[model samples]
Every structure is written in structure tokens, then in C-alpha cells.
Target: MHYKEAKHILSASNGMNLYRGCTHGCIYCDSRSTCYQFDHPFEDVEVKVNAPELLEDALCRKRNRCMIGTGSMCDPYLPIEKTELLTRRCLKMINRYDFGVSLLTKSDLVLRDLDLLQSINARSKAVVCTTLTTLGEELSRIVEPNVATTRRRAEMLKTVHEAGVHTGVWLCPILPFLNDTEENLRGLLDYCFDAGVEMIMNFGMGVTLRDGDRQYFYRKLDEHFPGMKERYIRAFGDSYQCASPNSAELMKIFQAECRAHGVRYEPDDCFAWLSEYEDKQVAAQISLF
Candidate 1:
């Protein structure tokens, strides 16, 4: 890991990435695509050393409180964060300013900040989003070798929800001919329902391949699923959206299950939940008898 002094911490949309690269080793990470233009190696994490100060300054200037988001471009809880506390410092700033937070990650290391998360929720809002690719742990290990497995993430979700912090699951990028199966979808949804997740975000039952990410994914496929990369080349050619042949049937089942469980399935709805900020004072006033 290396440190870089960032000029600004938050994006126009109030999202920030404290780090620029990841070490999770997830084969399908779109952040590695050539379009993102990382000057450093994907594993050479670039830490924004001044992220907390920048974020506090940004929040102070905001006229209205809205969720400050992170983990869209890079995972905040990378192993380096165990000592750096960059992400934790930003969370403390958000909490101190009474702003809400919603973060996405594949690491169970989030449990370490339950104190901050619970405090934020008790004031405004704090939603944790975890990605659930497949239920089978062995397959998950093959694809996301360095990150927490699916089962462990589910356990983390359960603990977060029990602590009164709303949680969501990103059941996404279901690699075709790999995890794109009805059984896989059902098992993942079962974990969400069991965890009482407020929402389940799924783009489709297939993956998108770009110049940088496609080559890396195909390479991993060649290494593990032999002959599968050739199948993808033959089937998808150069299309960006490689929808699974089973997308329609799987989506039908997904919709039905989400409705039955009352879990939000629409992307916009889940995103709205994450973005909406609450005024604790107004909420407290409304609850008074």
C-alpha cells in the first residue's frame, strides 16, 4: 500500500473511495477494467491519507444531510485498514457530524466497527451492504479467493441486522455457466431472507465483460473452469452485457421470492433506501405521545 494526498474526498454525489485499488482478489471486479485507468497495479492499494479530514470538511459545508457512501470503487476494509484506520476515521467523522452512511463490502471485517455503525443508526441511518455471489463456499473461494466466503458474510449480515442496523445484499454478477443457476439463486436468496435483509440488489443473472476485466476473468476461468473461457468467447463474442440464457426464468423466480419475503428487489428502491437521510430530532418528536 502507498499513500496519496487527495485534493477532495467526496464525489459530486457524496460518494468517496478512501482507497483506489483492492486486494480482495475477486476475479470479476469491474474496477480493474481499463476504463477506470488505474496507474498502479490492481493489488497495489492507493490510500487517500487525508480522506477523514476532507470528508469532515465536505460534510460541514453540506446544507442538508444525506448518506455519505463508500466502497463503490474499492473496499474500505482491506487488510491494510486493520492498522491504518482511514475508513474508521471517516466513519467517526460521519457520526460526529450526524450524517448517515451506507457502505458495500465483501469483508466481515465490518464487524469491527459495529460500535460506530450502531451509534450512527441510532442517530440518522447506517446501512451495510454485503455481496452474496453464491451459496457454495468452495466455488466462492475459487472466484473470491482472498475475501470472506458467502456463509461468513451471511453471518455478518445476521449480526448487523440483529444490532438494528438495516442491511442489504448485492446478489450480483452471477457468472454465466458458473453461478447462473436456479439453485444458486434460491440458496442466496434464502440467506438474505434468513438474515432479514431489507433489500436484495441484482442486476441480472450474468456478468459484464470489459477489456481489462474480461481478460482477467477469462484467465481465471481458464485456470479453474477449463474450456469455459472459450465457451464465453463463442457465446458472447464482444457484447458488454453477457446475459445468461437462464436470465428470464431466474429473474421470474427472483421476483417471486423477493415479493413473498417482502424484500426490496428493485435497484432504484434499494439505492434510495441507502441514500435517504433521516433527521433524528424530527423522528424523536414524531414518536412522542
Candidate 2:
């Protein structure tokens, strides 16, 4: 990883990616898309040296204390974070400002910030969003290699919920023929529900493939699933949305399960929930006064 001084940190939407590229090595990472236009290799992992300072400035200048989001474009708790502590520093800054945090990652390292997350939740909203592709550890290694396994992520979610912080799960990009089965869906859903996630986002039970992302995904398919690349090309030649053949049945089960379990499954509702910020500490202070 290389460090560089950054001019700005937070986006207009209050989201920040402290690192440009990732080392988690997810085979289906959309961040590798050509649209993002990375100057260096995807694993080079550019570090924003001034992320904490810039975040402080941005949060201080904000007229409203909304949710600060991260780990969308890249995993904030990458291996580099063990030494750099940039994600931790930024979380501290977010806590210092009493702003809400809604982070999405596949790493169980998020558990290390339980103290800060609990404090933030005490004062304001602190939502933890983790992406779960499959519950099979072996399959997880093949796809989301280099990151925490599925079971470990579920444990992290349970830990966060026990700490009184809200959590959500991103159930996505179900590789058409590979993990788009009833068994895979049920295992993933069971993990999310068992962990008591506030939301389980399922956008059509499919994956989106664009220029750069599609090429890499197909290559990986060829490497692992042999002839799967040709199958995909035959099924979705040049198409962006690669909805699984089981998407219809699987989505039916998904929606029904979410309804029975009372978990949020609507994408819009989940996004709205993430954007909402509640200052419970201020309310409690007002009550005391």
C-alpha cells in the first residue's frame, strides 16, 4: 500500500473511501469497474493519508450531522488497516463529532471498534452493514478470498447487535449458476436472521456486470468453474444485468422469509434506514435538563 495526501475525503453524500483499491481479493468486486478509473493496480491499495483530518474538517463544516458512510467502494478494514489504523482513526473522528456511521464491510475486524461503535450508538446512530454472499466457508474462500469467512461475519453481526448497535446485511451478486440455489439462499438468509439483522437487502437476487467487472468475473469463472464463462456468455452475452435462473423462485422465498421474520428486505427502505440519524444522547440530555 502507498500513502498519498488527499485534498478531500467525504463525498457530498457523507460517504468516504479512505483507500482507493482493495486487497481483500473478492472475485466479483464492482469497484474494479472501468468507470472508477483507477490509475494503479486494484491491489496496490492507495491510502488517503489525510482521511482523518479531512473527515474532521468535513464533519465540522457540515450544517447537519448526518450519517457518515464508508466501506462501500472498498473494505475499510483491509489487511493494511491492521498497521495503518486509518479506519479506526476515522471512526474516532466520527465519534468525536457525534455523527452517525453506516459502514459496509466483509471483515470481522469491525469487531475491534465495538467500543467506538457502542459509544456512537449511545449518542447517535451507528449502523453496521455487512455483505454476505454465501454461508459455505469453502465457497466463500473461492469468491471472497482474503476476507473474513461467512460464519465469522455472522458472528460479528451478532456481537454488534448484542452491543445495541443496529446491523444490516447486503445479500447480493448471487453468481448465476454457482451460488444461486435454494441451499445457498437459505444458508445466507438463516445466518442474517439468526444474527438478528435489521435489514437484508436483496436487489433482484442477481449480479450486475459491466465492462471491467464482467471481464474479471468471467476470467475467474474460467479459472475455477471451467466452461462457466462460456455458459455465462451464452446466457447473457453483452448484457449488464445477469439475473440468476433461480432468481424468481429464490426471490419468492427471500421475500416470504423476510416477511415472516419481519426483516427489512426493500432496498429503498434499507437505504432510507441507513440515512436516518437519531441523536439519542441529545434527547436524553434534554430530558435531564
Candidate 3:
């Protein structure tokens, strides 16, 4: 890990990635795509040393408080976060200023900051989002190695919901032949239902393969699945969007399940919910005054 001073922190949409590149080594990680230029290796994390200060400044100067998002390009609760405390510090700033947060991660390490997250939710909105790719622990280890297993992430969602914070799940990058089965989807959806996830975002039962990420994913496939790389090449050539043969069928089941369980499955609706901010405490205080 290396620290560098960043000129700017938050994006126009109020999202910030405190670290560039990820150590959590998801085999199908899209962040490794060539379109996102990285001067260093994908595993070599780049830390924004001035993220907290910049966030504080940006939040203070904002004309109105809105949701602050993070953990899109990289997981905020990566192992380094425990020591560096960059994510924790940013959450502190968000809590101090009473700004809403929509943080995404696949690590149970987020539980460490439950108090701060609950405080933010008490004052304003705070949504916890995570990705669930496969239900099998062995497959999860091979696909999303170095991160928490799917079961653990589901447990984290339950913990978050119990704390009275909203939770969402990203059911995506479903590796075609590997985890696109109905049984896998059912198992994962069951976890979501039990965890009481408010919403789920899925872009079909498929994965995206671009220049950089494609090559890396193929290499890993060769290493683990053996001959799976050739299968993908034969089926997809160099196509960017590689949809599964069973995408239509799987999506039908996914939508029906989410609807049955009252989980929001529409991407637009989920995103709108994340972007919307509500300050219940402030409203109540004003009402009292």
C-alpha cells in the first residue's frame, strides 16, 4: 500500500473510493478493466491519504446534505481498513455532519463500525450493500477469494437489518456455466429473504468481460476450472457482455422470488432509494422547536 495526496475526493455524485485497486482478489473483478487506467498492479492498493479532510471540506461546503457513497470500485472494509482506519474516519465525518451514507462491501469487517453506522441511520439514511455471487462456499472461495464468503455476507446483511439500517444485495457477475444454475440462485435468494434485504440488484445471470478483466478471468479459469477458458472463448469470442444461456430462465425465477418476498428487484428503483436522503432526527427536532 502507498499513500498519495488526492486533489479531489468525492465525485459529482457524492461517491468516493478511498483506495484504488483491491486486495480482495475477486476473480471476476471489473475494476481491473483496461478502461480504468491503473499505473500500479491491481493488488497494489493506492490509498488517498487526504480523503477524510477532503470529505469533511466537501460535506461542509455542500449546499444541502445528500447521500455519500463508497465501496464501488473497491471494498471500503478491506483488511487494510482495520489498520489505516480510512473508511472508519470517513464514516466518522459522515456521522459528525449527519450525512446519509450508502456503502457497499462484501466483508463482514463492516460489523466493527456498527455503532457509527447505526448513529448515521438514526439521524439520516444509511444503507449497506453487498454482492452475492454464489452460494457454495468452495465456489465462492475460488471466485471471490480473499473476501468474506457468501454465507458470511448474508449474515452481515442480517446484522445490518437488525441494527435498523436498510440493506441491499448485488446479485451479479454470475459466471455462466459455474454458478448460473437454478439451485444456486435459489440458495442465494433464500439467504436474502431470511436476511430481510430490502432490495436486490441483478443484471441478468451473466458476467462482463473486457480487455484487461477478460484476460485475467480467463487465466484464473484455466488455473481452476481447466478448459473453462476455451469454453468461454468458443461461446463468446471477444464479446464484452457474456450472457448465460439460462439468463432468461434464471431472471424469471429471480424476479418472481424478489416479488414474492417483497424485495425490490428493479435496478432503477434501488438506485433511487440509495440516492434519496431523509433526516428524521432533524425533522423531529424542527417539529419540536
- Model 1, C-alpha of 69: deviation from truth (Å): 0.6
What's the distance in Å from true for residue 58, model 1?
0.6
Clashes of each: 0, 0, 0
Model 2 clashing residue pairs (backbone)? none
lDDT of 1 by residue, 19-98 (tens): 99999999998998999989999999999999999999999999999899998889988999999999899999999999
RMSD of each: 0.9, 1.1, 1.1
Candidate 3 regions exceeding 4 Å error are: 285-289
Model 2 off-target regions past 4 Å?
A: 285-289
Q: Point out where model 1 deviates above 4 Å.
A: 286-289
Candidates sorted on lDDT, descending:
3, 1, 2
Task: State each model's CA lDDT, in order.
Answer: 0.92, 0.91, 0.94
Which candidate wins on lDDT? 3
Q: How should the candidates be ordered by TM-score, best one leading?
A: 1, 3, 2
Give all TM-scores, in the order shown.
0.98, 0.98, 0.98
Model 3 lDDT-worst window of ten: 196-205
Tens digit per residue, CA lDDT, model 3, 1-289: 8889999999999999999999888899999999999999988899999999999999999999999999889899989998999999999999999999999999999999999999999999999999999999999999999999898999999999998999999999899999999999999999999999999998778999998999999999999999999999999999999999999999999999999998899999989999999989879989998
